[model samples]
Target: MAQMTAIKVRGKRSAKPQEKWTSGKKRRKNIAIGAPSFPTFAALVDSTALNRPDQRKRRRRHICLSTLEQLPTEILQDIFDYSANIELAFTSRTLWAQLRSQHVYMRLTTRILSRVLGYEDKERASSTDLAAATRLLGCKFMTWKLFRSWLEEQRPGVYRNTDQFLTAWSDLRPSMDLVPPIKLLRGPWTSERLSFLRIFSRAIENLLELSPPHYEVALSGFAEAVTEGSPNAVGMLLSMGLAPTTEMVRHAVIDSGCDKDIVIAILSHRNCEGHVGDVSTTNVDLLDPALWSWAEKVRRDGNEKGEWLTRLLRSKFAEIAAVPDAEL
Candidate 1:
């Protein structure tokens, strides 16, 4: 090995010199031959940072994929509701539970509905007012289908078999009469005769995983159920007896557009799907393996049979459309 000699240069040509160390009574002196500026911990850190390879600007980590997740759950929920996303209950089980809170929806709806229906005071709703709101909306069973069981004095055996079913006050006539100004309302009116209370009540309540029962079959009222490709909503619709056919629905729940987990949930629902009702079918219905196999085929074969499996599940609305109300 050859011995290298230190060469000193002036100005920019000079290499940065190594920091010199001296014990006690340190004083400024002439620059050493090749000695560099004394480095402090901060200087070292800064140099280390400067030398590091450039990295892509780091993204902010959050509970959810976007920083929008950092906002208060209520505000996030408001965003979810105001935007095209409809409701979070259809998206995340955790977030839905935290944010879905039918209490809030029912609270706001009942308040607004009560005010609109001349039954509530906006500033301070009394217990009586709250009771009246609850009575009018009738969410006692938490779902309309369950309420129906109580109403008709019927066993839920038939409904429970399919797993879909809501509340009505005995004193209040069924909303079919569209009492008062409710009939004069907007184009989005449901198939049922909706009062202002019914409309607001249903709108608020539907911000849930499963919407109130009658609303599910209403023309165009089921928008939240089908919009933005919510797997929970899809599953709920199927559970509620919505036809699972591929034509009008594939656009809403396909893998290309929706979260994979949600699509999986929708495809895997067995009890809720119509395939189980078919006496002639020998194949197992909506099993994960079968559904995944079809999905894999779609991934491999390119949409050739992508939507074929969807035709197997039945939707409640489709079933209703297939049958006349008089017959129903």
Candidate 2:
């Protein structure tokens, strides 16, 4: 009975260890079944390595953007044609190189001039646009011949008719030979000369409204030109034998917004040479106290051009004073 009992005890102990081993195996199996199905760190590293070439290719493609110089010629030309500003061509050497062809220049000039002359809208140009056009016409690329050609193109038969009319009138009346010759009126067609024509055209239209005498109409046109602050207009009138009276000079200096250009134009004229030094009959000096006062106001107002003009006028006044009456 004692041996049987001892055998039962050993069997029970061995069964207990087997049961523990089975439980451990089952727990490991459950962990394996319930684990998440995500990629391991090793798998992620391998995938990244595989995609490296594709990533490099994408970066290279992003870096290889096309530049303006690489654009097709037609596209570039279209861009230039649409850009109305002449100064745009100067922004880049490539743009300048491509756009400075004679064909482009002529087309660009014509388009800008058309806008200035109000061909598109059939209205007169605004003051701002006219000023901009004047500056554009002063560009190095602009030429008198181009402007004249444009004028003829715009008014085809008018210039020809004008010349014919002038010739016919001179022939019909020999006394009309006293008038300024056709060449002077017709012009060497400078930009300034064209500007004068525009001013004179408006002046004539204004005079016609009042129906003034021919001489008064002509004189008023000259005064209007002076007051308009256009040096070319003033210069043209002076060149056409309009004497620069003391009042005219005083009016330009004191009344015409103290425009430096207009002042210079009047003082530089051949007709003005003798009169620049002449004092007014009203005891006002040609470079009057009123003009100096205006210059001082201009300086206080921070007009650099006006200040420079004042200095020029002072120098001119000094120069005149230094010269003897014998030279006069």
Candidate 3:
């Protein structure tokens, strides 16, 4: 009976070992069913691809940019006012469109003209003063009709007729007490206003200092224009019927820095060919000794324009000499 019991105990131990192995298998099966499978390289790539567009959208939402055209009208006008040149508006179509209004035009013209003419109190300027200033600045775009309309808008019924407006405009010069009046007071003034301003400002200085003869003021203005290297201003002055003298030409070549465009403008004037002959007889020293030396210096300095001016002047002199005094 003792041996049978011992045998029964051994059998029980063997059963226990089998049961332990079965439990271990069951635990491993449960782990395999519950835990996630390791992802493949392609699956990881697909997941990243799915997320990229959303990430890009999030980044895009965080960044913003504003363009010049998006700015307010007042801000645009302020930009125009602060700009170095009125031509800045012409750089872009959007800018030009923004600044094309009559109100903006008037404002810019008034501001720029006042600044150029050295007016301390631009706000105190009258309609007549503004009109005269516009004329002086050679505002080609500001037509008579436009100016009239603008004037009427500013001061209603002040100018009843064109004649009254003309009278007011004409009377502006005397009130300013310009001793020797500007030659071309009328418009179709096509010169660049900025270039005209630079040259005319200097001419005004000369006018105040010299107080030259009635005819000489125009001549002096031309001289100042030429000296300042403004070809357009010189042309405008000449168109105003300024008679260029021998002394003026000589001064332009010798005294004033020889600029090609200015010299060409003077020489190319309709009156220049005839005027050259007239002056040559009166002034024996038409071609000064200094002129040749200046030409040589200009050549040495490698200024092709200056060299061309010297050549043009020489050709003019040669033509004057070839033509008899009878025709002149």
Candidate 3: which stretches are off by over 4 Å? 1-214, 272-286, 323-328
Q: How many backbone overlaps does candidate 1 show? A: 16
Better of 2 and 3 by TM-score: 3
Summarize candidate 2's per-residue lDDT along 188-235 as a digit string, tens digits. 444545442442232222322222343353566567766666576566
Per-candidate TM equals 0.23, 0.34, 0.35
Q: Say what the RMSD of model 1 is.
A: 18.6
lDDT of each: 0.40, 0.54, 0.55
User: Which of 1 and 3 is the better model by TM-score?
Assistant: 3
Candidate order (lDDT):
3, 2, 1
Higher-ranked by lDDT: 1 or 3: 3
**How many residue pairs of model 3 clash at the backbone?**
0
Error of 2 at 205 (Å): 12
Full ranking by TM-score: 3, 2, 1
Q: Give a tens-digit lDDT track for model 3, residues 5-98.
A: 4344444346776566446566688678895556799999988987897655644453332487668878988887665356667767777778
What TM-score does candidate 2 get on C-alpha atoms? 0.34
Clashing pairs in 3: none
Which stretches in model 1 have alpha-carbon errors above 4 Å?
A: 1-135, 138-223, 253-258, 271-328
User: Candidate 3, 305: how far from true, in Å?
Assistant: 4.5
